[model samples]
Target: MTSRQPNHKIPETNIKKRIAVITLKSPAHLYHCVPIACELAKNQKFKVDIYTDTEQTAALIKALTEDYNVSCRIQILHPALGNRLLNTLTRHPARAKHIISHNQDKFRHYDCIISPDFYTAPLITTSEKNRPVHVFTFHGAGDRAYGFKQQLCLYDLILVSGPMIKQRLGEEGILDCTHSVETGYPKFDLLHHTAPKKLFSNHRKTVIYAPHFQRKETSWYDWGLEVLEYFYSSRKFNLIFAPHVLLMTKWRRRKSIPKRYYTSPHLHLDFGSSNSIDMTYTQQADIYLGDVSSQVYEFLYHPRPCIFLNTKKVNWRHNPDFTHWQ
Candidate 1:
């Protein structure tokens, strides 16, 4: 493959280049590259503006801006609709069209737009008069069963994580690597930080069960409850249930999983623990048990020990590298 730097270039700019960081969801997607963005801005040679959906993320970016003294402007992507309103619009096209027309122009006025949702939103900005660059970062689970390749072809630049992903995309005949880059994850830079305090300060043994969302025969609703039951009753360790964040929201309007499982007192369910940027739990947890999730790579930064659920053993043996755990 071409050099990683060429793909995700750190182009030298004598003057600060105005950058717009667009966060459609949680800033967790920014975890992979935000630090680099922050550093580039700190040089007094780059200005970074962040557009996020929530005040929580805006506040976080504001604090980072103050700490770094960079021009970190925060703005909301207007014309956003609540679940109730969106549901109503689905039934009424006239109302949806009005809402769409109102927010059409809010997408312009940016030099480069970096989005984590990995969809067509970034490309939408390219139609503006200035014609800014759009970058899409893949944050979803990649599988052969799913038609992910077709979905990925829509972006200008598709930034992937590891060498395995690079190889897989190439084998799939995805010639889009002309804009693809394997930037060694910026989030893993945390492992390089000199934090005095340990990531986890507890006497109790910890086990993190981070399961991926399964489609048919295998599901968190199916076999995962049993695993949770075992962890809840066991006195040997403290348990963390960090399921794929989308599983709770994507399938249904399930807000938060109730803490009723804490009947044993050793389990902590972090359904409310949300962060756009840093997920430090993967660094702190003692043992990680998960299915097919990318958190395994983050967990590997510390490399304590891990277990794969393997509830569905369809054909991972044919392609070992597909699974991060292998």
Candidate 2:
């Protein structure tokens, strides 16, 4: 017993799991993934990183990190091409390729890649070794065919809001029941718990007009101005003219708003305010008005009157594409 001696070395406990949360398009998309990112960042076992394209998105991510007291890195992905002509020729496929090439090494370093987009699916699948798990959280609740596309199968895990998404995936024969989870929309966690702010001080009933950005599907191209003018003139209801965030951002479609609309006290026009993403309008409004925006579902949480604008006047009752209308 006196001659016995033991040597022991402590095991390492400093290794942290790596996760990247990517928001490729807009601030709205970033909002959808913020809860997941924040949760992961809060855990000391994980190292969280966020990749965004725009300054607005970067700023928003920074705010979220500070607010949650979480340490995370935010990287901005700038446009690859400077030439307008070259960019115009290649479109999104070229951009996707550039993003993949730029982040290939970064993707290999992560344990998981979570994105609120479809394009990132291809990027994550490109990794051959130390391949990170790909997770997709769809950004909207709208009945769009693309939402249930076959490309989604590329993801290792799919987080959805409800049975509607699972059913849609099953119908498409792409449902991985083992990997799919109905998390009841992470965005709702913020929307439901946040106190409603008075967007308009007046007591008039408020309506939120949130039209989609698609040219073919949205009422904006056909009757957007008309709807705005109608509400502007109406003294019956206070209108929150908040279009889809992307609608006003497109260079080709950006139109000058009438000065009268801005001066009107009854109207609160927000092109892409932070309030729009936080569901302030949805929470405060008495009525929901929209063309194809999934925000209507958020407003429906309280089950109020909803008026859908069908500028195309398609037989929505019969068309599967217009299922949200039904």
Candidate 3:
């Protein structure tokens, strides 16, 4: 068999007999699918592989490997790239054969390819030989804003967490495929497994502020500072700030984010980095605060008092399908 090339091209073949998953390194997103992937692997139902190109993926793989030995390959597709050109050149159709040559045996084994998000299209396209069932887990809740339609258009099955997503996608006229299914987010299975743990001492309260990073309409960029101040001085409570991990890496380069000081002995801030705490922090927090982040669902698994930040003028409170509290 010939080796894979970055731009290798081949006539599409039928290879969707077994399956594996392509994972985005984001913990929030991966949390929904990893357990399911593990279950699939454990049952020997699918030959699974989780692919990522970020340091966070490495950290997550390390953490998960210790807890679950799910007989599957965890492949690092490539290092972070400044642009898609290099990634395209190295892993796209031209180089696909070269890329899969080492894993040709493994690639040929799976029938379906799954991804936690739409960004993994190139990896799935390259790995599957254009034959496997390409399923994507889309976490976005609304209409196509950032090339979402294009990204989602590629999937054979679009796995979503809620009905709102399915309805929204339909509104956008994305009903061509009969594969959209609501699996209720496999990551929430993790939330279901979490027992109530003490996030702070009995003398201190705990608040969790999880913010989304959508800057075009509403983001926590400016008001985040105000939130830091409000929580820092509240000595009675310990604060946990877990912003959407995407915020940290969105800019072209890593910009120096100003440090906000909290004199209160009870404040803690986390930006979803390798060193950040897991969703268990959500279980321990007494109150939850945020804009529009799915982490809210993670927090509401146990039904805590949640205060939505209306900073961006999102009227989410009255939304009929806000099922987190229900």
Clashes of 2: 0
Provide the TM-score for each candidate, comma-separated: 0.75, 0.86, 0.72
lDDT of 2 at 124: 55
lDDT of 3 by residue, 195-237 (tens): 5455445577788877767784344765777787777766567
Query: How does candidate 3 fare on TM-score?
Result: 0.72
lDDT by residue for model 1 over 194-290, one digit each (tens)? Answer: 2323323457888887776555423476577788878777767878777766555443424334456854566766543542125556766789887
Per-candidate Cα lDDT values, in order, are: 0.58, 0.77, 0.58
Counted clashes in each candidate structure: 3, 0, 22
Task: Report the Cα lDDT for residue 300, model 1.
Answer: 76
What's the lDDT for residue 147 in model 2? 80
- Candidate 3 local distance difference test against the native: 0.58
Highest TM-score among the candidates is held by which one? 2
Residue-level lDDT tens digits of model 2 in 1-326? 01101122223478887888988766888767877898888788888999887678799788867766777899977545553347677553225456655666667778778988887866555434456777889888777786877777777788989988788787776664326788888787675345668867788998888998889888988888888899899988999988888888754554556778887988988878788787888888999889878898888888999999888886788555566678
User: Which is the winner by TM-score between candidate 1 and candidate 3?
Assistant: 1
Rank list by TM-score: 2, 1, 3
